[model samples]
Target chain A: MDFVQENSLAVFGPDGASNPIHVRDTIRKGLWTSHTSGLADGHVQGNVVILPEVLASDFLRFCQRNPKPCPVLAVSEPGQFTLPSLGKGIDIRSDVPLYRIWRHGEMSEEVADIASLWRSDLVTFVLGCSFSFESALIEAGIRLRHVEEGKNVAMFRTNVQTEPAGPFGGPMVVTMRPMPAADVIRAVQVTSRFPNVHGAPVHIGDPAFIGIADLAHPDYGDAVALMPGEIPVFWACGVTPQSAILNAQPAFCITHAPGCMLVTDLLNHQLASF
Target chain B: MDFVQENSLAVFGPDGASNPIHVRDTIRKGLWTSHTSGLADGHVQGNVVILPEVLASDFLRFCQRNPKPCPVLAVSEPGQFTLPSLGKGIDIRSDVPLYRIWRHGEMSEEVADIASLWRSDLVTFVLGCSFSFESALIEAGIRLRHVEEGKNVAMFRTNVQTEPAGPFGGPMVVTMRPMPAADVIRAVQVTSRFPNVHGAPVHIGDPAFIGIADLAHPDYGDAVALMPGEIPVFWACGVTPQSAILNAQPAFCITHAPGCMLVTDLLNHQLASF
Candidate 1:
């Protein structure tokens, strides 16, 4: 595919995946409000977490405590939404395709823009998502069953408890991908190079070892069929914060709606640990 | 102090930290068989290790098992000394100012060059040293006590065991740096960005936690006096491979003499994790 078209000045690909600026511009103008799976192909797509100032420090600590599950990409100052470190003119209020508002740990509503809901005491945390590593896997010629089947990754809530920071404590949620034995080793090495995006697999082979009773059924997202000679490899998922928030029962918070993310200017390779 | 001298083309002042090419050229000609500290100021300096191919895989695995303590920068093919990835026109046999040959796990002699001893079955491993992160700390306005006192960083043999691979197994070695209370956090953040040269401190504040008994006594290197407000911060040291080899007792090996290293074309900042 021609990654960039000569005439358009924008990268042209399937579903306009070439230009991150154009994707964000469309998102900012309210013209696009969908999952950013195929858009801005190589740029980082973040899982957003916005919480009150009182809970911000603890959440930051929580992320630090569980780096593999919650690798932080960028954090914004209180009441400040222009995250210039992540992109050129990213106004967090409108850049994310969709936002979910949580009130007292309850999911209240999903909206296109969060400008009306922006509060002076809110702090934003942009966390790395699996899309970054998936891009790397694809580039490395490792076939992802989830992407090939056009299904959301199978995520399961495990008995593997996370190191709690304040009230943020819950079982870690992980997404599973089934691959052959040889790819398992390569997957670990490749993912370790990208610690910012959940470095390395948390578990490989058996789902039962981590308290998951069934590989055919998952807590969230659809299950892709495990092929012959393929073993299930699990990675700490970004949805973990959502799981922790539900248990912690914070007064108020915001997150990107499932699959709808804040696409940043940082290329996927830029997030590599090396 | 003037970091660079006005009249000298070489990074002026104190021994004049010159270009890496110039330093390498001088070393290759059998002159300048001294410690490489303060030479090639901004470039990456490496811990040299050469072992037979039979033990090479195990040593590589050992380094991976203990990344913080033994971060491998590059590994050369059997009998291959030209590490093109690390620098230009680099002939490993002559580029390093000094070489120490170990026979039956005992240091037999320190030599200016090892071309005569080089064998077809030998493989080279360039492990990262602390100079990369120390340079970063200096840039960040963090004063290193060892550097200020003109002494080597204090190194300790800790009870903290390394994950063994094959015959390579031993207690990890750590280096200590003392900094004021406020700089400890900044130091962690700074060093974490340079994982190649021992990322974020293994421990901070207390010495007893990692099994070190006395702050005044260290296993290797001269100890620097800890200032009143400064607390000891410890990092996994590159001396670990030497420790491992000592315990493993390989028949033969070659390493750079302490403080003498293989300086490469790679800039220190190029090793940053970010």
Candidate 2:
């Protein structure tokens, strides 16, 4: 919670949706620095990844080879913080809700602004997150257990291998959702439209199939309730890039804090396959 | 309506879903000949195409090249009467409810069974049909105008060109559905999951954008209501193959008459992208 001010008023009126730029506007002015899960409804919220120019090409190739886990919503030129394609005006250096400074293999600090850390050789990558598809699923009346329980989704490291590109290769990470057997099919249908996000579930029904032995114990995030008769569905998690980065242990990088994300001007509907 | 005995009871149990074998049994005995819709609930229904060996390769290529227009669910070996892949005991000649027989590029007769017309050189192809995705859409609570009005979905020829394979190339045909702005997104999401069928829409919004001149006057099927504020959404239609068959004018061929399809043991949920 390191943002400047609470300006939910400027972004959203009685209609309940604000221009995505307003959300960025608040963040740019240092008014807000928190999780952007529901801000600027119908717009894209993304996972942030910043790395030195040397590692950028391989990371981009890794994203291209493993799109389900690392869909590139926007990528910045070397040392350039402005992602003009994602919005009319985007200053990537300080637009995200929060930033995590990674030195070697460990997180060093949680910061609200990254202007002082911005370097001429740093490249930024914005990967699509699951929020866009989740909105679509909710609209279709398919209940998400974690959303209802108000907990972070359960995530597990899977045996499913990612297509390797240089030092960016690692086992895929996936987020889990528990739903009735009937809703699983509908969930797949709704999420498949937003490939820019995670697209469709990588595995469904049995957690064992993806090498998760226990539903109650997830490697990351809180384990939501998995009621009887409900199957645990898994989608390639955005944390996969973090996992890869951790294994590769790049010299220096910056990413959004765990729950915090970068909100962009692009509409969720615009990411749809149709 | 022209097949044999009326045995919807043997196929569907009291709860409405029966073993797919039962549906095939009734068809094998010449006991059921009407449209297979609603029978064998949760099972797959496929569009059938039978052509001589000389034309099979080209047709197969066409299906592969244009999966959205003609998704191949199952294909039989040349002169093969039994589609063992689709079911346990399926005699392609008689399992279908009814079929249209063609000779020298012209339709010769609409008959109850193709047993009298089965040929050793004939090749059978079972294509994924719209019914699979349509069932998923309705179950997700997306209202369809054609399904509500009890009329066939309105279809039109589009300027979108199909990938040509030998003589199988033709203008793609698309089915239209009208819905308010809100449901349009959900419909696009729902249909995208069933790529084995005609996955996701090829076009949304104005029909003219895809070369359709009149939504009121469709080239095939009946047009339903297009209310104010509702934009017309279009999906690649399965009828593209039928249109190709008519234009290619193969010397001899057989297809399930429009609306009648081969019901199989595969569940509709099995086609989901997850």
Candidate 3:
């Protein structure tokens, strides 16, 4: 099956048939290894960041200092993989379908599971992912073109600088959505309810204002076409932590491969601060 | 004593001890008739509107249709003059310090109390005022120019239209505040906590985009100078409902005089949906 059909079949069916924990379990057992854009309809998906205990405190401070992009959802104790705070049975090592292995801040390869690489000093940090807010946006009746097209949402690195913490410091990375101004307001109101995910847009008008010179040339993800009358709205992205980790260039670090998120049993609606 | 000083003494001091009920009782009496700003810290101050029951349903429909500007905090029973749902011992006829009487859309007079003009056919609507969000802004450490300059907030007519309901139909009216882009984000996050009170900004950046030709020439309230690098942010003002009332040209209506407001027993923080 194609990527779209494969990902679609994993979710998009009946309500109770597929849950977040079940999706994670399927991923853990090597039965599924694909992008999680549309999977686990009503649960929270998290961005994973694992590091040695020595560098964990600095990363914690980094997320605390810059919350818009690096919204920390749950942090695990040293050597522990289960994030009980996020859900009842969440194992950091194998829950996410794909894991990225990095050495000296450079990605070496993507693996199905990190059970072999797990060390006693490894500390896992689950950061809020944009999927939570995207769920909210769709529920508000706002049409997201990327979802319809079955494409990866466009992401870019901007000149906006995040407040630095210890060794973790870098430019803010953001995800872009082309939306009409009217829908933009509704998007802001809807996303603002989910602060655990990236809260409202940081910049709305000209891309140049935030140092993005061209909309067509995105630094990271695939560039999507902007329809006429649709302004580019940017939100701080969880990829920022990944960028920071790459910059920090630690001896060893692990992150969930893009499109392979840690699915938790927590309901998305439960994340609404309101 | 001057108006500000007299009202300030009642709510201000080292302790800042004026409770919402205490402030409402003082306003109900003839002792206080000044603006209720900064009084009863952490309590909600509502925009008052009284109309005959004949127009009550239409106005209620109007508020329902256009929730951003007319967030219904409390709606009184027909002709009851008491809003027990909002607070204890709260009488709409006497709780507000000053009332403006409008006849056929024209301002006829201002009075301390509407007891003499009370009618069983009247209905009271207490709207979530900007004061609640403004308090949130102040608490977030964003400076409001009008509050800092001791002037009324600037308000203007916008080209944007509210969803129409029966006889209540008119262009949206908005309040403006100038702030640096950084503070604008802070302001958005702060005000978003109180959706009942005009919530987040409706527009930002250029005033001309909203059809206002000049920043200094507002349709109502005082115009404060815009400082360097400051952008004018607009919020759906409660005055839109008043303008809608004027358009309908109701035979008789009452509202809190400009600056003067209805002090409620509900704490401002309690109105935060989050």
TM-score for each candidate, following the candidate numbering: 0.53, 0.52, 0.52
Residue range A48-81, candidate 3, lDDT tens digits: 9999977875676577557679877776667888
Cα lDDT of all candidates, in order?
0.83, 0.82, 0.82
Where model 3 places Cα greater than 4 Å from the true spot, the runs are A1-17, B1-274
Runs off by more than 4 Å, candidate 2 = A1-274, B1-17
- What is the clash count of model 3? 1
- For model 2, what is the C-alpha lDDT against the true structure? 0.82
> CAPRI band of model 2?
incorrect
* Pairs in steric clash, model 2: A3-A32, A3-A33, A4-A30, A4-A31, A4-A32, A5-A31, B5-B31
TM-score of candidate 1 to 2 decimals: 0.53
Candidate 1, residues B1-274, lDDT tens digits: the string is 0011122233233445467877788788866777788888899999999998778756765765577898777777677888877899999888887788898889899888999998998888899999999999999999998898877889998889987766988888999999898999899888878887988899888898899999899988887788898899999998888889978888999988887889899999987755
Choose the strongest candidate by DockQ: 2
Over B1-274, each residue of candidate 3 has an lDDT whose tens digit, in order, gives 0133345463333544377777777777766777777777788888999999777756765775576788777666567877765788988888888899999999999899999999998878889899889888988999999989987889999999887766888999999999999999998888878777988899998888989989898898889999999989999999999999999999999998876788877888887755
Q: Identify the superior model by DockQ, candidate 2 or candidate 3.
A: 2
Clashing pairs in 3: B42-B268
DockQ, all candidates in order: 0.02, 0.08, 0.01
